[model samples]
Every structure is written in structure tokens, then in C-alpha cells.
Target: MHPIAQPRRRQLLQAAALGVAVLSTGCASVSTAARPRVVVVGGGWGGLGAVRGLLATAAADVTLVEPNEAFMSCPLSAHFIAGHQPATDFQRSYSRVDQLGARRVRERVLEIDRTSKMVVTATQRLPYDFLVLSPGVDYMEDGIQGYAEARAQLPVGFRAFEQMAVRQQVDEFLAKGGDFVISAPKPPYRCPPAPYERAFLIAEQMKQRGTKGKIILIDANPNPMPPAIAQPILKGMKGLYANQIEYLTDTSISAVDMGKRQLVTSSGDVPFAHANLILPMRAPALIRQAGLGERWANIRLPSFQSQVDDRIYVIGDSQGTPLPKSGHVAFGSGQRVAEAITERIAGKSPVVSTGAVDLPLGICWANVTHKEAININVSGTVVAGEPPKLKFTVDAEANARSGAAAVSWGNGMWKAMLG
Candidate 1:
């Protein structure tokens, strides 16, 4: 070997050995020994947000526990009901999340073992240093009599992946032409404007297809719940679908006789050929089983830390916050919860105290027609001594601009969630 080359080779070997030693020492450190494990339940907007954030962190070993193989968005699902968009447009793959090093488990969480800090699934028990639950909402079947048994026919397409079922029914209604009844439940449900948007979109289809049918929208509240978007929603209903949609306020579907196709309401028994009963919603059964709360998981604001269980963080529509149950709020809550977990792992104090964390933000849309929409933006803040205050900024009326923006937002959000 050349004299200079021999020295250079030795130097290269020493550098390689030093690099290996450093890597080994780094791996042996307690902080790197086992990266904090974060298991996120549900793969909806909120869950995806947490997973993405955790993946972005080098300190987290993220595991996404979702039963569905793919994600389907509840937002803009009205278009599917109206046949303007296909079901595939909302469905997204989990492959991107998997590629990000998140252990994607396609299994439903059976129970949460708070004592062991493990989530029990059918196949395996997942151990997590931090847990985030965003399982979304479930309908309260007790409010309306005979609803549980007739749930199949009376599709409540509020949840993701269930929109296709309602869309099929709506398609049949448009083809056959009958009384298409869409009922809106009280406030605090998932997507407050969804039922109205569904009505307007379907009514637009009715006019274009000449379905010879009128949409009967029975709202539980006197106007719209949360009151802020009432003017815009009512304006859309009257101005856009005046002839095709009939708005009934202060009326609720108390009971449903599916065999007879009649709905008993506060006003009176209404007969309908096809119906979409958006039932009252509550937290998923797992939440109550885990002793979270009756209607929702009682969480400490900002931290999203569960009041019942400190190790668990509940975000999205599943938590009992006075914020609107929109995808925007869910996504924001997910990111907030992930950051809180990261801070905890780093042994750092929270930027915002558990007593006074900023409330989640909400962005919801109501389609007045096929080409126009009403948008609602909500910002909430929590003070040390006072309850959370939510402010709503709504579009004056439905317009083509908002309609186009809604679609763009949907595309961007879906990309953020799945891409």
C-alpha cells in the first residue's frame, strides 16, 4: 500500500468506528432506549391529526388503532347524497400513515385497561405511554322509540363511511319520486349543518331530476341550534329551495313507525316514503364503558386530558366541549393533544396550563344549493375563571365562492389527513 493511502485508510476506519460508537451510545441512552409509545384510537380527522404529529416527532413510537381499512370523511358528504360526488372522493387509504412508521392496526378497541395503560383489542393488547381517543359519536337511540330496530332503513349518515348507505336511499328517492323526509336533531350533534345541507343538496337534485317530490326538513329547534348560523341557513332554505324544500321548526321526530312509514313528531304524525333521521348523538359506548361520562368523555380543556383517566386524552366530537363538532375542531384538538403528550414525554411544563388552554376552533359548511354554500367559522377561548366562549363568524348568504371554497377545503383536509 502507498504510505499516504495507508494513513488515510486508517483514518477512515477510525472515523467509521467512532461513528458506530456514538450511534451505539445514543441508542443506549434512556431517552432513546424506548421512544414514548403513543397509541391513537380511531382514524378519523382527529385521530389522523394526532398520528401525523406523533410521526413528525422523533421521540414517539406511534400506533394507530382503527378498525377501518380506509378513511371516509363526513364533511362534504352531502354531495354524495345529492350525487354530485362519488363515495370514493371521500375515502382515503391508510398506506400513507403506515409509510410514516405508524403501526397501523386494523382492529376495534374492545376495552381500555386504565390500570395497565393498555388498549385491549380482539387480536392483541396495545401498550401505550400515551393514549388519544377520537372514536367519534354514536346516536342516542333511546330518544326516539323504535329507532334502534329500524336503524337500517332510517340511515343516520352522520358518521364517516355511513354516507354511502344514505346516498343509496337518496338515489332511490330521486328515481321514484316520493316524500323525502330529513329530520334534524337538537344541537351538540356531529356536524350541526349537515342535515340542512343534506336537505338542500337533495332538493337541488329533486329540481334538476324532476323527481316530483318535496323535501320535508323537520328541525327540533325553533330555528337552527347554536343560533348564529340560523339566518344564513334559513335564508338558504327559503331563497334556494323554496319550492322543493319545506322547513318545519320546533318539531322533532319523537317516534318512528318504520313498518307504517310514519314519524310521530311534536307537530303531528308525518307519513313519508323515504326518511333520513339524524338522531341525537352521544359519545361512543367505549367511552361510557371506560367510565368517561354518559354523553361524552369529560376532558380538561386545552390538554384534552380525560377527567376520569389521566393517561387518556379524548379529542374530536367524542369529547364534551362546548365547541362545534366539526372536522376542523377535531383536527385541531388532535394536534393539541399530541403536542401535550410530547411535552409530557420531554419532562417540560405545558405552555398553557390545564386550567386555561385555548379552546378548539371550528369550521363548518352548509350547502344551500349544488353551486352555493354558507360557511361558519367558530373560535373559542377559555379563561382561568370563566367557561369557554365561542364566537361564530358566518357567511351572510350562500354564494358560488363559498361553494368552491368548500370543495377546495375538503380536498386540502383529506390530503392532510391521508396523504
Candidate 2:
């Protein structure tokens, strides 16, 4: 077990006692009153985590506002993007969330009225006592010239359902061998190792099918992201796909000329038969519209409460924190936020711990092949008014054990989220 989770266990025990005291002391006042409305946006890993924790408390009326009726995972969809698995493998219905008494609204959030405490949709507005925002991210198409008009040709596949489009591109590339371009954006993107993992899996396919093409992996960073997994990632890339992949480091995409199928990069213009331009990403427009933050929602540590709005909490990749943007971290952050909200509902202030306290743990896997992967784990500690101190443990090389564990972990998480 990670050290970060130990202190949290003790905190949970304390919270349970506090909750009981609140209920026993004021049974009549609560029994006759309306339940607190907790509005959760998005239906991905983090949103589902918040829903599960909120439902377990039975203290609030949870309403999940998601554009999609189903939940899809971006973590393991690299298999689907590489044509090794179907997209349905990483998708699940939200029937379980509904069964747990969460009101599921299948509509895009138009705006968040913080003062009114309501989330506005196109047709209706839902009032809330507390709001949880986990809207994921949006690509910065303007980061590259001509990318806006050529959106149809380049699919980033970072979000849910977008993997299918990238899979189609992969299929076409495999069928007709040529220069297939896959570029990695700068750090702080969703799943830092995903672009390289996508390339590795597709390169594996290239080897199996004897595809007469090269995968041009243009990385904006000098090494694999987070630095901890760079050596392992580079070793795997060189050892496994030396013939299939051509890695270019410190190469930034400046523009795209769709007419010529050329990517204008800091390195130079490179022509390709197919391109998957994983552009820079930022929090969804809703965050900026609500004055949350510029690039992401500015949130307070430990609590995840919005800096500008006390009633609003932001988790997952949307929050501007030093923590890694990973599904594991997002889900854990959701759970932490749920506990904080429940304490407020119980008429108790949140527990403010001084000294060192654990933050969320992040677990990410970079699948080098169909049956091999590299595991990365991140643990963190934070002081009251200081930035978090993080520690990373990454596998030295791709191995079969981590690959199998990756699948098992995905199954367990999906079950916890949807089943």
C-alpha cells in the first residue's frame, strides 16, 4: 500500500464518528427537511467516483449531468485505437449510477451560474446546493495553423469516443503502408505517456503485419513525460520498434498544411500519409465561462474547492493542480471531495490537517505491446500552505506482469464505477 493512503484511513474513521453525532443530535430537523442537492458534471472516472462516494453517504441528492448516456474510459482505449480491441471494451452504461439514485441528465452543460447555484443546459437549469465539475478537456486547435479547418483529418483520441476515429485512421494506415505521423504535445496533457503508448501499440501491429511504413513519433518534450519513466519508455521504443518507429525529440508542430499533408514543425515540414495531431489541451470552455481559471480551474489543495467559488469543487484533469492528470488521481480526488461535502452537510467544518498530509495517488500504465506494459505510480504529500511534494515509482522496462495487471485494474475500476 502507498504511504499516502494511511492517514486518509484515519481521517475516514474520524468523519464517521462526526457524521453519527450530527444525525443523533438533530434527527427531527433533518428528517423533515429536503435533502441537499449535489450536482456533478461529467460522467467519466472522476464524476463516477464522486457519484459513488456521494451515494454511499445517503446524505445528498446527487444529480449527474453528462452529455453522454454511457461512461467510456480513456485509459485503456489505446488498445482500441491500435485496433487490438473493440471500443466497446472500454465503454459502460450509466445504468448503475441511475440505480444508485443519481439523477442522470444526458445533456451538455451550457453554463454554471455560481451566484444562482444552478447548472444551465440548453433546455433547462438544475439548481444545486453544491457543484462538482469534472468536464475533462478540450484540444487547443488554434495551437497549430490550419488545424481548425483540417480537424477532420487529425483526431487526438484523448477523450472518450474519439479513440474510434483514431482507430479508423490506424486501420487505414495498416492497410496502406506509408508515413503515419503521431505527435505528442507538451506536458500537463491528459495522461502524459498516452501518445507514446499509442505509438508503441501501433508499432507492434506494424511489426506483426509486416506493414511497409514507419511511425514518425514527434515528441515535443525531450524525453517521456514526468521524467521518471523516460529511460524505460525510450529503452522499450528503441529495443522493440527500432525498425518500425522513427522518434524525433524536441520537435514541436507549428502548423499543418492539409493540402500537402505536411506538418510544419520547429524541426521542419514533414509530409505524412496519415496524421494524428495530439494538439495541446486545456480545461473545457465551461471552466473559463464560469471564471474558474484560465488554463484550468484554480482549486484549493486537500479540499479541491474552487478558489473563486466556495460552493463549487473541481476535480479530475480540469483542476489546475501539480498532481498528475490521471484517472486514478481524478477518482481519488473525487472521493476526497465527497468526504469534504458530507462533512459540510453534517454541520461540521472540514478537518484541517497541519504538517504533512497525503494527496491522491496516481497509477498509470504505458502498454508497449498487446501483452507488455510499464507501470508508473505517483504518491504525494503536502503542507498547509505549500505546493505538494510528489514521488514517482515507474517500472524500469515493459513486462508481461504489469500488462496483465493493467487489464485487471481496468476491469476492477470499471466495475467500481459502473457495475
Candidate 3:
């Protein structure tokens, strides 16, 4: 357990009790006659967390507006991408969330009418007293020239369900060995280590099957990100996959030449039989459309309330924060926002803690192999008015313990979000 989580357990318990009390009292006032409407957009890890929490409290008329009827996890889906696990392993039905008394709307949010407090969809306009946006990320395709045209050929499987296309490319690469190119974008992108993790898992398959190919890993940054686990990541790459992996750092793919299956880079022209170019990412256009923020939603710390609109809260990778775009952090932030909204609805005025308040711990992992990984846990704290401070606690090396824990962690998180 994290030191901060243990100390804050008492406060969490108290908040949970308050939530129950609020809901119990709401029952007497007619089911949802007087309750406020909470419109949660996107049904990924973050939205599900908020939906699950909000539904428990019965504090609001919660409507989860998501395009996808089912949920697919981007985190830990590398196993599926590398063909080590089936897609169903990382996918869960939304039945549990719907069964928990949430009105699940299978529709994409076209716009956010801030003034009217209504969410515009193609077929409906849903009004809300409070809104939660967890729209995930959109790729910056312009960074790599010709990429927009060659999207089908070059699948960036960073997003959920898109892994299938990348898997096809990977399968083709493993069978007919040649250059399998994988690119990593800079920070503020979704899962900084994801590209490398995908490479590692695929490299493991290459080694086992004796595939005659090399994985050209081009990184936009100087080292693997967060910078804490770079050493171990590099160690694994150099020590284990030296013969199979060619690492190129501080390089960006300026153009994609899918006609010849070559990527134009600053360093040189690299050819690939198959490629999974993980491009730079930003919050979905819905954020900008809503006047939330440009690249990401501008959110106030601790509360996750929008800086521009007090009624709107943004969580997950879509929010512009120093926090790592990890599912753990997103889910935790969603839960925190649920508490904040409930408290506000319960007529409790916003109270800022004077001392340093502990924020959520981002528990992240980078798998060196299917059975070994390096754990990186980031702890954060913020003073009443100062910027939040983050500290990284990382494993010294890739170990089997952390790898096993990573699977357990993924299972636990999936259970929490969907079940």
C-alpha cells in the first residue's frame, strides 16, 4: 500500500459514509425527481470509475454517453497486440455498469453546449447540471508526413480496439522477417512507454520463433519516458534483445513512405515490412469544441473541475496535467471527481486543505518480457495554492515479482471499472 493511501483511508471512509447518507436521503425525495443530472462522456477507465462511483451514491441522474457499447483497455493490451493473449482478455461488456443503475447512452458526443448545460449528440441533446469528460486521446497525424493518407497501412495501436490492425501487421512481420518499425512520441502523450512495451512483447515472440527480423525503435525523446525507468528499459533492450532490436533515440519520423514501406527520419531513411507508428496525441476535438482547452482540458488541481466551466470536470488522459497518462491515475482521478461533485451537491462548500494534500499515486509498469517487468509508482502532493509536486519510486531492475503483480493489477483494475 502507498504511504499516502493508508493515511488518507480515514478521510476516504468518511467520504464514503457521506455519499451513502446523501443517497439514502435522496430516496425519500423520489428516485431522481430532485437529483441533479451528471453526464459522463466516454466509457473508458476514467468514465467508468466516475459512473460506478456516481451510481453508488445515487446523488445524480447519471447518463454515461459513450460511442462504444463495450469497453476495451488500452493499457496491458500489448499482450493482445503481440498475439500472446486474445482480444477478449482485455475487453469487458458494459452490462455490469448498466446493471448498476446507470443509463448507458450509446452515442458519440458531438458538442458541449456550456451555456445551455446540454451535451449535443447526433440524435439527441442531453442536458446536465454537471458534466464529466473523459474522452481519451486523439493522434497528431500531421507530425508524420503522408501518415494521414497511409493510416490503414500504418496502424498506431495506442488506442483501444485499434490493436487488431497493428496485430495483423505484427503477425505479417513475424512470419516474413524484415524491419518492423515502432516509433515512440515525446511526453504528454498517452502511455509514454507503450510503444516500447509493444516492441518488447513482439521482440519476445521474434526470439522464441527465431524470426529473421529486427525491430527499429525510433524514439522522439532522448530516453524512454518518465526518465525513471529508462535505465532498466535500456538495460533490457541492450542485454536481452540486442540481436533483435535496433534502438534509435532523439529521432522523429518526419514522413511515412508507405509506397515503399520506408519511414523518412532525421537520422536516415528506415525501411519496414510492417510499422506501428505511435504518433503524438492530444485530447479529443470534443474538448476544444467545448471550449475546455486546446490540446487538453484545463483542469483545476485536486478537484479536476474545469478552469473555464465550474460544472464540467475532466479526468483521464484528456486532462492537461503533469500526471502520467496511466489508467491507474485516470481511474483514481475519476473517483476523486465523483467525491468532489457529491460533496458539492451535499451543500458542503469547497474547503481547501492548508497543508500538503496527497494526490493519487500513478502505478505504472513496463514489461521487459511477458514474465518480467519494471514497476514505476509516482506519488504526488500539492499545497493549497502551489503546483503539485511529483516523486517517482521505480524498481531497480526488471523482476518477475513486478511482472506478476502487473497482471494482478490489470485484472483488479478491470474488475473495478467494469464489474
Candidate 4:
């Protein structure tokens, strides 16, 4: 060995012999044995944010528990579903996250053993000093009668990896040129404007292909959700897709008749050549099984700590907060929860949120065409014991600038989470 190399080699050997002296992740260096264990459940935007933030601090023994081997962005996947972009454009490998020195568990959480502070998987039990749950949303198939049985045919694609099936449905609809149905559930679902966005993109495709059919969009709400971008959404449907789209408001799907290829609704029986029924959504079953909230995880605002257990935190759409269930908000909440955990691990006193505590800001885009979109931005603040107040700023119309910004935002967010 060279004179300079020998000293570094000896130092490395001594550190290895100590077993927990130093582990460097290019971000921070700390003793492995002295760090608190943090188990993050899920690998979506929220969970990825928590993992990255925690790893940056080198404050916890982070373990990311996710079933999917790769990450997919549901934020701007309308381009993929509408055939304007390929699925690979929105998919990325988990290799970047794995390279950060966190333990990556490729398994679904079968149960959360809160009493034991362990996450139960099929083959292992992961014990954690602090747990961050960001399992995202699960569809309420029971909301629409007979939807459970016909789920394979009607893909919601709100969650990751499910977009491929919905893309197939869209592909057939564009090729065959027949009546296609896209239903939007009531408020509190993931991405309120997604169903309308999907409709608009497909309608744009119809115009391009000169398809001989129309898209029937049924909404459970009186208008487009959040009531912020309803004007622009309606205007787009009426102006650009007047002949190619049929808008139905104040309607709900009662049942799905797979045998007849029809939807039994409050209005009447509606037929379709292809259907993408975005059903009502709630937190996944793991939340309720773990004694979390019934429909969503009960979490306190400004902290995102569980109401039942301080050792656990829940972010993303799974938590029962008034925040918009968009990727931006989920990732922001994850970053906040990570900071809270780092403080606790450092033995710092909790900051009393007596004054106005700001929550995560929400940003979402509704693409009226593949090249034009309407932007909605929501900013919220809350007191210690009061309901959060949310203010919305939405574009009055869709434009090409917002559409371009949407793509840039997606790319930047993905880099932040995985890079």
C-alpha cells in the first residue's frame, strides 16, 4: 500500500471492528447502533419523502417497507393513460433510494402490531422505535353495488401500478370508437380533478383520431370537485370537447352490470364500450386493522402524529385531514413528519403549535388537452384546536403554460424523492 493509503485502510479496519463507529451515506455519518429505528410503510411520494429526509439527517435506522419494486408517478400519468406518452416515462427504479443505505423491504404490510411497535409482514416482523405510515388510498368497492365483482374490468388507476390496466381500457376506447364512461366520486378522494382530466385527455385523443364516439362523464358532486376549478373544467368540456364529450352532473353509480356492459345509475341505465369507474376511496385496510381511523388514519395537523400513538405518524391520502390528496401535499407531509421525528430523536422539546401552524401546500393540474391544463393551488393554516382553513387559487381557464409547468413539476418532484 502507498503511504497515504495505509493510514486510511487502517482507519477503515478499526472502524469496521467497532461495528457501529461510523457509517457514511454521502449525506451524514453516525453510529448505527445509536440511531433510533424508523420504519416507513409504503414507497409512494409520501413514504419516499420521509425516507429521503430521515436519511439526510442520519438520525434513524430507516427501513422502507413497500411491495412494489419500482416507483410509478400517478401525478402526471394521464399522458400515459391517454396514449400521449409511454408508461416508462412515468416509472423509475428504486435503485436511487436503495443506494441511500436504507433497508428496503419488498413486502406488503399484512398488519401493524401497534402494541409491540412492530410492522407485520408475511415473512417478517419489523420492530420500529418510530413508524411512518403512508399506505395511500384504497378504493371503496362497496360504494358502488356490484363493483367488487367487476373490479378487474373497471380500473380506477388512482394508485400506482394500476394505471396500466386503465391505459388498456383507454386504448380500446380510442380504437373502437364507442361510448366510454368515466365516473368521478364525491369529495375526499385522491386527486379531485383527475376524473375530469382523464376525460379531457381521452376526448382530445378522440378528436385527433376522429373517433366516432363520445365520452360520458358522470359526477357524484354537483360540479367538478373542490368547486375551485369547476368553471374551467366545465368550460373545457363545453368548449373544446362539446361534441366529443357528454357531461352528467349530480349523478351516482348505483351498480355495475357486467353482463350487459352497462352502468345502473340513479338517472338510468348507461351503456359503454369501455369504462374507468373511479370508485369512492378510503385508507387501505391496514389502517383500520391497526386501530387507526375507520376510513382514514387519524392524525393531528401540523405534526401528522397519530392521535392514538405518538410513536407513529401517517401522511399522504391515508390520513384524515382536510388537505388535498395530491402528490405535492403527500410529499410535503412526509418531509414535515420526518423533521418531527428527528427532533424527538434528538431529545428536543416539542414545539407548541399554539399560534397559526401552516400545513402543507397543495398543487394540482387538470389537463384539458395534452398541451393545455388548469392549475389549482391550495394553501392552508390551522390553530392548535381548530379546523384548518384552506384557500384556493385556480386558473379561470386552461392554457399551454400550465400544461408545460405540470410536466416540469412532476420531473422535479420525482428527482427529489428518488434522486
Candidate maximizing lDDT: 2
Write the candidate numbers in order of decreasing lDDT. 2, 4, 3, 1
- What's model 1's lDDT at 287? 94
Per-model lDDT: 0.79, 0.84, 0.82, 0.84
Task: List the candidates ranked by TM-score, beginning with the highest.
Answer: 2, 3, 4, 1
lDDT of 1 at 375: 80
lDDT of 1 by residue, 1-419 (tens): 00123343234322321111100000011133577888999999889878876776538889999988889889887888789888888889899999989999999999988888899999899998778999999989989999999988987888877888898899999999889899888888998888888898898888888898789999999997668888988887887789998889999787999889999999999989999999889999999888888898998665677887767889899999798898877886776666566666766543433343345557677888878888887766676556788888999999999898788778777776777
Q: For residues 102-197, what per-residue lDDT tens digits would candidate 4 score against the true structure? A: 999999999999899899999999999889999999988987888889889888899998999999988888888999999999989999999999
lDDT of 1 at 382: 71
Clash list (residue pairs), candidate 4: none
Q: Please identify model 1 stretches exceeding 4 Å from their true place.
A: 1-33, 352-357
Which model, 2 or 3, shows the larger lDDT? 2
Shift in Å, residue 57, candidate 3:
1.6
Give the Å error, residue 94, model 2: 0.4
Per-residue lDDT for 68-136 in model 3, tens only? 878899988898898799999999999998888889889989999998999999999999988999999
- CA-only RMSD, every prediction: 11.4, 4.7, 4.3, 9.6
C-alpha displacement of 348 in model 1, angstroms? 1.2
lDDT of 3 at 288: 95
Which pairs in model 3 have colliding backbones?
A: none
State each candidate's clash count.
Answer: 0, 0, 0, 0
TM accuracy, model 4: 0.92
Error of 4 at 82 (Å): 0.4
